[model samples]
Target: MFHTLKQVPHSIAFPASNTVESGAAKEDQAISITYDKSVTLVRINCPRQDGHDWVIEAFTALEKCGMAFDMVSIQPGEVSFTVKSRLVDSVYRSLEKLEVYPDSVTDCVKLSVRGRSGQPLLSSMITMAETLAQCNIPLLRLVESYGLIEVLIATGYISEVRKALAKNFNC
Candidate 1:
């Protein structure tokens, strides 16, 4: 059926043909399947900056930012996100605010996202960081007492950051 359809529309489609007959009359069950499928994410890549938006609230009623999402994560790393022009209008009709990344939004971004778990594939990148890529997440060690071991982030800190994220965000 995918071959015959010039384009697939939304999560459902009209099946073109079930069968062909020469003369005999037959009953066509006529079945269709509609899937609740929608894109889960939008990705962007930009650089880190100070006072970036993790959440953006329009300053006035006519003010337009047209951003939306469920959760946001920003690190001093790479990644950026954007919305296609066609989607901008309809998507912007909704009211409310947008949570920006903790870091900057302008620069040579690697990837950015704005949606609920839109980037499931990011788990692969996290795993790759554990297995192949150089360690980068910030890390800190708990001081059992005041003025004990000072907190520092370096190559030796990768494992600790991973542990913290795993514990805090269940990542």
Candidate 2:
């Protein structure tokens, strides 16, 4: 039950510059779409059944290590976060000292679509998801905040997903 963009006739036009063929080749040649291979998802579960306290403790440990993270999910007894793979060891060590053990560590890549303040967030997300789905790329996780939409996907499919997004969004 997600919103999907209805297909409009090709005659309903966008500006020449925004047309796919006109700009696709140029952009594709100029910039290569690649995923960050060094991203890892770290899942922390609090046996004490304290999601909030563990979240704070995890963030505090991350802060102490000067590592940046994206909060993935939070439940009553589990909290998952992600950090760059390079910082995993350091962050893990820091958390271990704090008595927080990661329940799982997974590798993932992030793709972000950013827009101006008034951009239609929900529509954009649906379009992006539909594009990826058409290309047979699975969206592992999704997060929307402020003016950004971040999608977590398997690293292996990132290039294909990016191409689909660019094609559909006319990026």
Candidate 3:
């Protein structure tokens, strides 16, 4: 009943590279992990409860495919009026895991600037991204410490990180 990560159902996940976190990240060194719900709003269908079920089906499919999401919303636009409901929303988890470096520790991302080539830098970035994903530290904690584009490929924070960046930079 689940979908592949690539075929992640639109119901369970909103396909966008939008902010997952609740607020903006202001620190300069914060690393963000925003996800790409990545799907576009393409078409519309007839209004019916079956549409609600369809959305739920998509979300359940996504879960089987290794993708998770929350806050399912269904909206029906009719010639008369619009109706909406939250069909399926995943509960927020506190995680409550132990600290990594703790709040007292400060980190930095020092990039070696080169004029023409970015391969070396990209390679280095990929490695670093893998490491960050493995850290097992809570993503919000990492972001509270560092900023977005600071951690491009953090697997765990992929959904929330990019959002933090846009909020802080106002871009």
Best by TM-score: 2
Q: Which stretches of candidate 2 lie over 4 Å from their true place?
A: 1-35, 103-106, 116-122, 134-136, 166-171
CA-lDDT, candidates in order? 0.27, 0.59, 0.26
In the range 1-171, model 3's lDDT, one tens digit per residue, is: 112123211111111222324454322221222232221111223334544554444434444544443222245621111011111111111111111110111121111111122211122233334444554433211111211222212244443433432443343
TM-scores of the candidates in the order shown: 0.20, 0.64, 0.19
For model 3, what is the error of residue 52's alpha carbon versus the real structure, in angstroms, after optimal superposition?
Answer: 0.7
**Candidate 3, run of 10 with poorest lDDT:** 93-102
Global lDDT for candidate 1?
0.27
The TM-score that candidate 2 achieves is 0.64
- Scored by lDDT, the top model is 2
Please, what are the lDDT tens digits per residue for candidate 2 over residues 1-171? 112222211211111232332344211121222235557777777746643776887778778877777746886776777777777788779888778778544567776554333332334455557777798877667776753566777778765765565566555
Tens digits of lDDT, candidate 1, 41-159: 23323322533342233223113543433213343443322222243343434322333222211111111111122212212223324422233543221111221111223334334
Model 2 lowest lDDT segment of ten: 6-15
Give the better candidate number (1 or 2) by lDDT.
2
TM-score of 1: 0.20
